[model samples]
Target: MTVFKVFYQHNKEEVVVREHTQTMYVEAQTEEQVRRYLKDRNYNIEFITKLEGTHLEYEKQSEHFNVEQAE
Candidate 1:
């Protein structure tokens, strides 16, 4: 499994802003797996970035970098 940072808007009708967007970390085998694991909602998906190497290391420094396991 790999860690991914998903940026999305809670409301699909609202315009997506980088600053206003919400983020979550998910563990999944693939990008498709991550997408499918998310709850069914009207989410304005922004970006899904796979974190590894130095990037993953950097994120670990933050207090908010909690990984969510996908069932």
Candidate 2:
């Protein structure tokens, strides 16, 4: 298995809340698997913000790790 760094955003719709960017380290064979793993960890897309100007996004880091680790 390979290690992946997943970058995602979590935002709240409150009046005085800032958007949150989160990172996750996942061990999977493919990027799709990383996404699935994140979902299983309760990072579902429904929690992401979908505002008109700013929308939450996620991406797999270009750097790969042989071991599992996260920040």
Candidate 3:
């Protein structure tokens, strides 16, 4: 599985700005898989980016970083 960083807004119809968005990490096979999982929660997905190498390691260091495995 690869790690993805999902930026989203909860229950909002308007475009989610970067500063106003919430983030989460997901381990999924593809971007579509991540979107499908998050759709259940009805989050307004702003972006999905593959995280790896140095960037992925940097994010992992944050106290708030947590990876949710996508089933």
Candidate that scores best on lDDT: 3
**For residues 1-71, what per-residue lDDT tens digits would candidate 3 score against the true structure?**
99999988886677767778999999999999998888779788888999999999999999979999998
Query: Tens-digit lDDT track for model 1 on 1-71?
Result: 99999999999898878888988899998888888888576788899999999999999888999999876
What do the candidate models score in CA lDDT, each in turn?
0.89, 0.43, 0.90
TM, every model:
0.89, 0.42, 0.90
Q: Model 1: which residue pairs collide?
A: none
Q: Among all windows of ten consecutive residues in candidate 1, which has the lowest summed lDDT?
A: 36-45
Candidate 2 local lDDT, 1-71, one digit each (tens) = 55555555553332322255455455567666656555545442322221122111223322432334222
2 or 3: which has the higher TM-score? 3
Deviating ranges (above 4 Å) for candidate 3: none
Q: Which ten residues in a row have the lowest lDDT in candidate 2?
A: 48-57
Model 1: how far is 10 from its true place, Å? 1.6
TM-score top scorer: 3
CA RMSD for every model? 1.2, 9.9, 1.2
Worst 10 residues of 3 by lDDT: 10-19
